[model samples]
Target: MGVPRAFPHLKMRQRPVNISNFKGSTIALDVMGYVVKGHYRMMKTSGLADDNTLPDSTPGVISSVEDIVRTIVAAGCVVYLVADGKKLPKKAKEHAARAKKRENDLVMAESCFQLGLKKEAKKYLARSTVISPATVDSLKGIAAKFPGKCFYFGALFEADSQLGYLAQNNLCDLVISHDSDMLLFGCPKVLFTMNTKGWGFYYEAVDIPTALGWKKYSYEKFLKMMILAKCDYVKNIAGIGIARAQKIIESSPDLSITSILKTVTTLFPDSGIPDDYATEFDEAYFTYLYSAIVDPMKMESTRISPPPLDLTEEYLSFAGYVHSREQTLDIVLGNIYLDSGRPSRNVTDPSNLDELFPPECFFNSMYEHKKEVLEFDVDGWEGPSPNEDDDEDDERPKKFDCVECDKTFDCLSRLLYQTVTHTNLKAFSCHLCKRTFGYRQTLELHMRIHGGVRKSKCDICGLTFTRQDILTNHMAAHNEARPFQCDQCPKTFKTNSCLHQHKEVHLQVRRYQCENCDLSFKRIRELESHKSTVHYKARPFKCDKCEKDFTRKDYLEQHCLAIHTSERPFVCEICNKTFNDSAGLRKHAAVHSEAKPFRCDICPNMTYKRSDHLTRHMKDTHPAKLEEFMAKKKKAKRPPATSTEEPKKKKPLESTSKANIKIHKLSPQLAKLVGQSMMSQIDIVNKINDIVEEKQLYDPNNHLYAFGDQDLVNVLGVLRFKIANVFNLLNRHLE
Candidate 1:
């Protein structure tokens, strides 16, 4: 399994992407995760075994995968169905432990079901759902439908590693999966939580800086964080979470595995960190970095990336077991059993192969076949033709081989270039940046940035870029394209990346309901505000002039604007009517119009420009139907509410003590001002309030009473005046 809650944690930064956004792109789909998810989804929704038995969700799972693959192919995407082959040797114990737990859970589920604990039984049953290699095999039939468009492959080890390999090597444009670890594996782009509708959350590795709010970050640091928080191959140090791991990595002077581990040991000495933690971390890291993947071009097993020269044979085993070229081809062809190293009996059927995989099926672009159809052996095994010998292919040219890495190149010049990669020699250097390159061509390309040599120019905004790909990306901003539309709202975004963030605001409206009262809130923020205002009776925002306490800053601002200030900033354009807030101005402007846009369903003749006005008419004219209409309206406006009880209140002294503990969190300037004050803390607070009142800072009519300072000069000037007055008052109080 991936790091617990990894997907959800990363999902906050996910961009909402439409399925069609990836049109004409090759996407590697992690078939196993979806297979498991589909099984759970069907079991939960269909309730196929409504009685006291667990449902066989195999059919439902096949249907779900089929729907997903077909939908993706329908969008003009070339789909690669990546299936899990064998578990890594390191994960054997974990797998065994999970298997035992599932067995126990299944027993408990059946017992609970017999006792009529349907809900409890379902929870246990979900945990017991087995997604085996056979479940993955069932999906081959689905892949057969769009044979040319969709191809199937079984990874040597993990499907995620295979997907990541495909993405990193440019075999696929995107990796679509539910696992967040795919990102840690250095997949450039991954689409998570995919639905059949083609909507999903998208992530690109280049956006890590923006996503994590970091000035800069590296893939190495990201992988270390995942390993520290526990991954498939490594155990985690106790008490360390994803957030803590990130902080630990950020605080390190050096983000190297060795330096970060030293820092962890220093920070959490008693956390019982494993002695071989470094080895485990290295294994996990290299496993993600150089995992074995089947090359679509060569049709053979190979590491995702070239392994280090110093890598041990034992460590290399973490990637995957080395398989023969024939075995690798058979695995990709789905002719062998994934769980056991044996030929799949069903795959031997010539009729199934002929029907499912047509002559043009499979990756027709990659392989050059000698025959039109696949040949089967007398022993019920399917593979390449028995007549084809490796010796026949040995006649191909193998000159210009690099001695250092055993890599062959077609030309001597290319071999010379490859040789430079193994050495420190850089004959070519950029004059502007002093950056060295092994080749003259690369140095020339680097000079384009300094010379401002842009060949690609946008027709829309007339912006230029050094590269055509950069210009293509920039064109998206000017294309007036908003492909990502919210399913819950009409709002659209240029990219799917921010769609989920925007939808969160609307999706949770009235979702949190108060158990103690009938009140519900549109967001967690609203519910929190309700709790702080009504339940706890906490007034955080205080009006300095009137010494009145308000639960919200806006409420305090409104109080100051209405009660103390004569300023009416928001004015109706149609009329000369003024209001304190823009909302009031908008409401006032509606009255000036004669148009009645909103029509009452109960009475077609009754129409009003405002929706609320139409609602009011329904209540007044059709009282009986009003409740029904309002009920429907309320349901439409809000999703089902989850009951949340009022949080237990802490004692006043306890709350104050906690507040005092956090006093160090105050700004250094503010803390210094408080420290230098002659008056008591309470008296200083009152004095500051008096100064604010005297300055009329909250008065919107005053020149200094701006909602915000637009520039550094204005901010500094306002702050300087306030500090001077406060200092004078402190000195006077001391005297």
Candidate 2:
């Protein structure tokens, strides 16, 4: 059995006397969200210019262990950074080079691979501890990396796990992060947990309430109320938060979460959470923030429904933005998959499809569309204010530029470059949310999103959403035509979100990231959704057979099947096995090279592509690879290769500007491509003919078309005989 928790919620459990046992220790921050927020705040606070900053400077401070270490040293603490060292040497080199890294990226990521028994890890074990995610099958993986080798590290975490050990054993002083909910997990202390910036940044422990005088409750009560609010959020309630929950509790000082839980259990069936409810909460929180949240309004809102989305028509009626919410989601998913052609969305097939996309619901594709991706601008105001139309009437002039970027723009947006500038304003405000913004135009936009107003309405059904694309999609249900079909399942939606959400039914995964620090989540939207709704956020590494994203790129490529892809075009002189991905092929061939031959730059890594990828791999994965390789070899030289890989063209997305926005919004180019690639035009026409013919038999009164075109009807006398003759021929062929 596992060790039990202190049940921190139980009253009279005075701060454990040994709490200081966690003091003065070091913690690793994901540094992604914070980094981005920091940069945004800096740019907003100080209008920057080219000479003052670097281009792509938004991934705020603390990109590397080196940076963290510097901060730690300044604070007078002994610290060590936990890293996926297998890829370190490569990644450091990439940071040195300003190569193709993303503009808003926190730091370059280097893929960690399982290599044979590592000698360095064993040596490091004697001095410092190291940890990896808890999901790696190290016994099998280690054996493969070093058939006869053994390794020892001071400490080692698994491939995708962090908690069972970290929790039972106190590893540090406090967990610090933007999300303060970690206190519920029995974390000792947390700081820099507020949403404010810079000078406003402050630290708080579990006992913050006592520190700041509360009328009826203590600090623990304060923590409990906030945690309750987070727990309630996991259930889809929109207006619940720390303040609201606090106010509720303060109004009834005698009420505690224990009582609330009891009432909920008695009243709300299934509130008797299953044993692993904690894990569920963590997954939900992580997904809500990292993957996709269920919002009919926001950019990362959960997906649902058919198209010409029900919300699209309504939004276009008033909202001026030409793109609809569903379209935005399509673009985001397109970016992630890097598919130039939009994959056909078949959302009409799911049984519970209505759970997400109700007629009046809205949502967006979040994983890909960040503020940086959209490049939106914010306006600034000074004194009483000066109108944009009356710019000449202003006494003070505004100025700014991005230091690291190539171009400069006004501080009006705080962003460097953008395709559109904000001019029309809205005065939309939500009484429930109590948040106000710049323009009437902005207010109108917000109102549409928050249900204050409806911007999109389906022409076919009059269903609405804050976004227009959804309404257009809703109209597709009345289309009388369903074209897109899934290769894996019978499930389909009129739109992609509906279809994909149904697909989640077959997936099996539970990836966990400690919200206590900074880290990146490819599925942040889902994480946020989970956090906003779940109770105790437990840690679990997910292994879904099919996933929109994975903890590691290679995990799902070959189904994580024991036998990897044999994209082995490069046959080993020693073996004749084939391979699929070039990287796998190279990994298999590594045994044959005697010259320590597969050096990527200065790092001890393998290579698949020629110089560009190799150089990139060195710079991004192993900073030490290139220099070490040069020093070990005495000179940088290449092995003679008689054969090489053919240059492959990266398929870029073709803009669907003139795409048919009719009832069925299928792109003409995609339709043609699908006809040519998946099936022939003749095949499509034949399939349609078969459906038409089948329908004709059921409804004898309907006009029959001999040709495929709906407009070309068969003249009864001549076509009747022709249909019989063609079908007769078809029967003979079938026979």
Candidate 3:
């Protein structure tokens, strides 16, 4: 739902990392989703929902937040727990849709209960999750336990935008969330799908270019594509998905949003695009680019980016309205509840709140009104009311504009008919599969696939499509009439647009240049691979099957195919020799050629078709010289280490101060050893130094613990006393 399938589409950039990797760094966590999930789990397990309202799941929500925050803090990270404060006006449509869904789920749950399906009833009941103000207040109590280690922030609207702001401004080192909207909000680093077992998928914004196979990285183009792919704020053009949106963006001139939209409209002329699509696109763009976030340091509300001087007031409100400083502080501090809009000024003073109202009273009355509204409206709910002017305007012969899409019509009847295309409510449903569609035409189109009634059939592939244009596009694939060919490379395309896109590769400026050799690549990964393989000779990618390592991931994959896999997909045309990969087959084909391009340097008479054969000839024919040759090759593989730059000299140990010894609480046994002979002191000091240097017991950078052999002989006495104490405890336990 968030840019649809964005998480899976970015699988290439996702890295599985342990939670401990962020040790000693600040992380901002979005806890609202976990709140809903925890409530569902509790409702499902306990099966104690009251009237299917889940009034008892509040404790489970609190426990969930506590568990998640404590788990992260235990891993040595300082967590900034961020929760949603209020709903933004831009998301009102989405909120209504969700409310309708919950209402429908309630009806389903009630029906299941009547039919003696208790388990199914509970399952449907659990999906009706609502995060309330009481949940946010409970987070304050959880944060209090850890003090500086865990700080809570109640966002003005969305927690993801707040988390993104924290990450972008370096207020936090990482953001822990599964929301793809964080990517659109410009969070530099996000850890998604993390579990309590300390593992998660990680992605960085800089990896987008390499992961998506783009010649260059452009956040503007990426955001545009994600918007066109569909988001919470706007509906996407029909028939266009992530792949097609990317193609459209890449092909557009000047790489502007307007041009991209124009391209989309051209590609999908009858896709029912909104008449005011340009405005919606801008709103979605600004919503991601300049979301309102509370500054953790300043404790005040502010937008992520400064608004343009020429920007309108309406666009500015997309970030959220600015309230008084006191109101903003109260909201950010979790004094105001998110959903009910109730003020709990005494929340910070728990002693007063408990005296005024019992703790159970505060929670038990949390959502009683919400439950009543939902239960009463389940059957009689008729959705939101139509505009009051609809009936009056129908009598006049005036221009009518559909409110959802802004499409104008001469008559109100025509406008009402077209408005159905954009509304979420569905009246017409498929009889065969019981699927609903907003329009009858759409339902009929869906039925064609189920009925196998495709009208347009292909002559060559024997495949059929519902529409002529789709069939025409499919026919082009089998046409094989590539009249347009690339002059730079041995490639051809059926269309001029495809050929033009291919030609761009030749002209693409390689902006990412290697610092070591100045070799350029169109993408950052290529530059990274060149640096790792050609300059550093670092083999970081390793094969788990054979323990063979390579400098690049693709090289490791190829090695796995050639060694571990039995499937041979590529075959040599001349000798019929099969290989697991195309590169191996190509190498094998060279053996059948008359030309021998590779000649051994040590043995000039020996010639071979492959470089590896020449290397083998040199090794077998001249073993002694081959050793020297390998040494030279290895030396050339990596840049020579600079000898002029001297290694960092270790600082001489300072004398241990009395204050440190007192703070560390030296044992009486250590004091007894300190009063012994100088010879014994020196012996103990040397042994202690050996242990310290070998095991790295003390921080090398800590001047207070840096000890000199002559001045810190008592250190060994202290260590011996501690070791003796441990053994004594073990001995006592054994008895």
Off by over 4 Å in 3: 12-14, 48-55, 114-116, 349-735
Task: Quantify all predictions' global Cα lDDT against the true fold.
Answer: 0.66, 0.33, 0.63
Each model's Cα RMSD: 27.8, 34.8, 29.9
**Which digits, one per residue and each the tens of the lDDT, describe model 2 over residues 336-403?**
11122324332122223244332321121221222221111111211211112121214222553334
> Is candidate 1 or 2 superior in TM-score?
1
Q: Which residue runs does candidate 1 get wrong by more than 4 Å? A: 8-13, 46-52, 107-111, 256-258, 345-362, 365-735
Candidate 2 root-mean-square deviation in Å: 34.8
Summarize candidate 1's per-residue lDDT along 639-700 as a digit string, tens digits: 44443654434245554334223312323344444454233433444444444444444423
RMSD in angstroms between candidate 1 and the native structure over all alpha carbons: 27.8
What lDDT tens digits, residue by residue, belong to model 3 across residues 1-735?
367777767662236666666777777888776676677767766655455555568887788678778878898987877888777766777878788677656655664455454665676787765655567767778888886578667788888788877777666778888578888888887777566655666677877887678987788889988888888887567778888888788878866668877787777664545557788888888888777777644556788787787875565686586666666767766887756678764355322433433222211123111121101111222222212211221333377656667578885436545655554456565543345676546675776555545657788889978665677767779887988899998998887767876775665455554444434555555665564455434454556777576756677778888888898989777778888998878788887889998777755777888867867877888887888877776665543223345533322233322211222222454434334322232233333334444444432322113233322333332221211111121221111
Ranking by TM-score: 3, 1, 2
List the candidates' TM-scores in order: 0.47, 0.26, 0.48
- Evaluate residue 403 in candidate 3 and report its C-alpha lDDT on the 0 to 100 scale: 61
Candidate 3, run of 10 with poorest lDDT: 369-378
Any idea what lDDT model 1 has? 0.66
Candidate 1 backbone collisions, by pair: 15-496, 15-497, 16-496, 19-198, 510-522
lDDT, model 2, position 226: 50
lDDT, candidate 3, at 671:
38
